[model samples]
Target: MHSKIELIDMSKKNPGEPGIEIIESPEALAGQINKAEVFFLKNRKVVLGIGGAILVAIVGFAGYRFYIDGQEGTAQNALASVVYDFEADSLQKALNGAGGNEGLLSIADNYKGTDASNLASFYAGVALLKQGKYDDAISRLQSFSSSDLLIHARAQSLIGDAYLEKNQPAEAISYYQKAADYEKNEYFTPVYLMKLALAQEKANQPADAVASYKRVVDEFPLSSEVVNAKKYMGLLEGQVGK
Candidate 1:
């Protein structure tokens, strides 16, 4: 009987087999390293330039942040000096400054990007409103922005007050609605809603006024403005019925 023997094929080992390994010769490995070195040398200038640019950008941003921090501190100090004038109702002195201290207008105009400058705009707006400069008040108030929920809503409400003083009930209604709707909560929403209803009434929108007032009464029953809202709503309902 003839015996049959099968030889293992080392060159054609299955690539997917678990234990299969391809070992590179020293010459092949050296050639790959040489190619990588050549590529790095060829693009050395480009790589260095990109790295330099990233370093410069990071340094420049850090410097800018440092400068802004210094400016904010200065602005807050300047703003603090004028707060007493504003609180005491010395509107002109607050707006224009007294002695050597900077005023609201200067802080707002000079500081520009600082938080104190933004607060100066708010204070200046209210000062202008008290002075009966409604247009100027609106301009300053519109320029002021805040992330504080209560303060931001108060700014919107103040703009409505400015428009109301200007005898523009339509404009007043729009701003009042914005105040009432912005970040609605129990503490301030009722006050804004009351203003909105008053603006609606001024604009001859009795139904809208009643609805706004009803919202204050129903949505914020515990609010200080709730009693006024209920009284206004009842009056509006009677007026609408007539």
Candidate 2:
């Protein structure tokens, strides 16, 4: 599943120290300035040392940001090159590049802190899942983190899908529930709720499955999933009653 790439803004300025003392007159202001000068003269060596360290820190931070920004661009380009393979269903080539292009795995491994690296994890996981490598898919998906609600919820749902493929319905239920509950909305929540219900049914929790399905029908009546949810809910409710 493709998602919008979101770049994290790390730029921030240090806030100035609070609580300024007011000077009632020019004399008082001059006196404060003189006292500051005298104090600086007394602590000249220490002040210079602290100032030098702060300057070094600022320069180092700026340089690191520049380096990471460049790395992020490179990683993004590499990722874009491989994503075509992914979209074309060339799962192997997508995961492990071909013909001089770096693959999703290489981008993820080579550029650790870049946003593209994080997105590579998601792409790699989906490719692994398509390849039927459930365990590896789970690991790759777990490594991904996103602040976007839709993407994060989709990742959780994909994890649930991997677990379900492995026949671990209980684990699938947990992740599906997480996906269903995360930033609940009409567009995605009902879909996740249906998955949660199916996983619950597979786990032999008839009552819980019924509840999950009923949520889709009642809470998301306008959703496309509601018809199927209602059908499943009726079936499970009858079983629960029996």
- Identify the leading candidate in terms of TM-score: 2
Alpha-carbon lDDT of model 1: 0.89
Estimate, for each residue in 128-241, the C-alpha lDDT of model 1 and write its tens digit: 999999999999999999988889999999999999998898999999888889999998888888888988998999999999988987889899998888888888899899
TM-score of 2: 0.78
Ten consecutive residues with minimal summed lDDT in candidate 1? 1-10
Clashes of each: 0, 0
What RMSD value applies to candidate 1? 8.9
**Tens-digit per-residue lDDT, 142-181, candidate 2:** 9999999999999999999999999999999999999999
Please list all clashing residue pairs in model 2, or write none if there are none: none
TM-score of each: 0.76, 0.78
